[model samples]
Target: MNAPRTVVTDLPTRIRRAEPSDVGALALTGAATFLESFAGILDGRDIVEHCRLQHAPSVYADWLADDAVAAWLAETVSPPAPVGYAVIAPPKLPLDDLSETDLELKRIYLLSRFHGGGVGRELMNHAIAESRARGARRLLLGVYSGNARALAFYARNGFVKVGERRFQVGGNIYDDDVLALDLRA
Candidate 1:
């Protein structure tokens, strides 16, 4: 009897909880997507170092150690796969001190190869669902002001401009805008 062939196209690309085995691949995917997604918007050195330091094994290990952190990694059955990932966590601040209206969409990124393929929307859907499940009434994120693509994508996903802050990376200064989405409505 012949074994059933696995069809890559039939494999679902939905987001799910990330596993330890996904560390290396996910980091690389995040780094690639960051550089490719921000090519013209950020300084080359800044991007590279950001990925190196932020996506390093230790960083992911640390993230995994956080009990409150939840991440979803996108995958397909195809060879050389893995399309994207998103991470969400409750606000690190005291909820009592702040309003009940706050949650954080920590990160959502995809490989350049998967750009404009609805992968991002799928990830956002998962994140929003998770946040809603957790009783969060709002979602917020910060993006580099120079990263127009990310800003547009966030806006398209229902986030609105809330405010701005200064961020520095690789010795380069940048202005970042804060965006938020009210989930209760």
Candidate 2:
């Protein structure tokens, strides 16, 4: 007898929990997406340094080694190329006193070519499911204040503005809007 599928999600890209072995792919995609998403919106030198330091494979490896962190890597099935990813872990948002039940969607990005293809939603859904599975009562995220596309995406998914943060990218400081989703609802 054939095994029955328990889920019916039709994702545009294949996504799975990122393993230690996927550190390189994750690093590359993170850097590429970060650069593509901020090219004109941020200083060129700042973006370069930020990508070099923040998106290093060692950074991803550390995340993968952590017991509390969960990362999902999205890829093209035929070419097997990493196109996007999402990471969720214990809250580290601008909130002064976050509850233990709060989790943050630390990162979610995709190559510019993959935008509007439903892959971002799939990655987000994966993060939401993982947060719920881990007993998170709320999911939080931070997006650059000028990133209208990202803000729209988060809003469409029911995230609401809750706070603000001054985030550092390389040597520059930028404004970020913190958004939260009530998972219990």
Candidate 3:
């Protein structure tokens, strides 16, 4: 009898827990993705400064060592590259009646090239699961009010707008909608 032939397909992108060693890569990906997502609408200097301060390697290193924070990265297996990432941490702001079990989805950013390719969804799902595993009953995030694409994506994923806040990036202040997802339900 002839040996059976084996067929192999290209490995799909995957999501993995980010470690302290990944701080540099995460920082770079975070900053690049942020710029790709918002540069057209925001001032270049503000974006540059914000990315430097918020997505610096030192900041990621600190987060990696914090027990309250969880992070994940998405990468393609064929030709490895950090395409996206998500970060979840203890809530920085109160969510009215839902304060006790609330966790914040601090960030969920993907390279523009991977935007509609399911990477964002995978990252989001992983973040949600991680939050739940950490005892979070609700997940909250603040997104720019004018970002219709993000608003629609969050809506599709069961998040509902609960409030509004002002978000500052350098000297600019943007109106943001605070959205919440009931993980317990």
lDDT winner: 2
Could you give candidate 3's per-residue lDDT for residues 5-92 as a string of tens digits? 2322243688899999899889999999778767778888889989989999999999999999999988878788788899998887
Colliding pairs, model 3: none
Once superposed on the true structure, which residue ranges of model 1 sit more than 4 Å away at CA? 1-12, 92-101
Clashing residue pairs, candidate 2? none
lDDT of 3 at 150: 84
Clashes of 2: 0
What TM-score does structure 3 among the candidates reach? 0.90
Q: What is the C-alpha RMSD of each candidate to the true structure, in Å?
A: 7.9, 7.9, 8.6
C-alpha lDDT score of every prediction, in listed order: 0.74, 0.89, 0.84
Residue 139's lDDT within candidate 3 is 95
lDDT of 1 by residue, 1-185 (tens): 11222223444566677878788867887788777666666798998878888778776666767876778888764453677888887654322333555778878987655556677888999889888888787887778776766788898989997776676656577787877888888
- Give the Cα error of residue 88 in candidate 1, in Å: 0.8
Please give the distance, in angstroms, between residue 178's alpha carbon in candidate 3 and its true position after superposition: 0.6
TM-score of every prediction relative to native: 0.83, 0.92, 0.90
Find the 10 residues in a row with the least total lDDT in model 1.
1-10
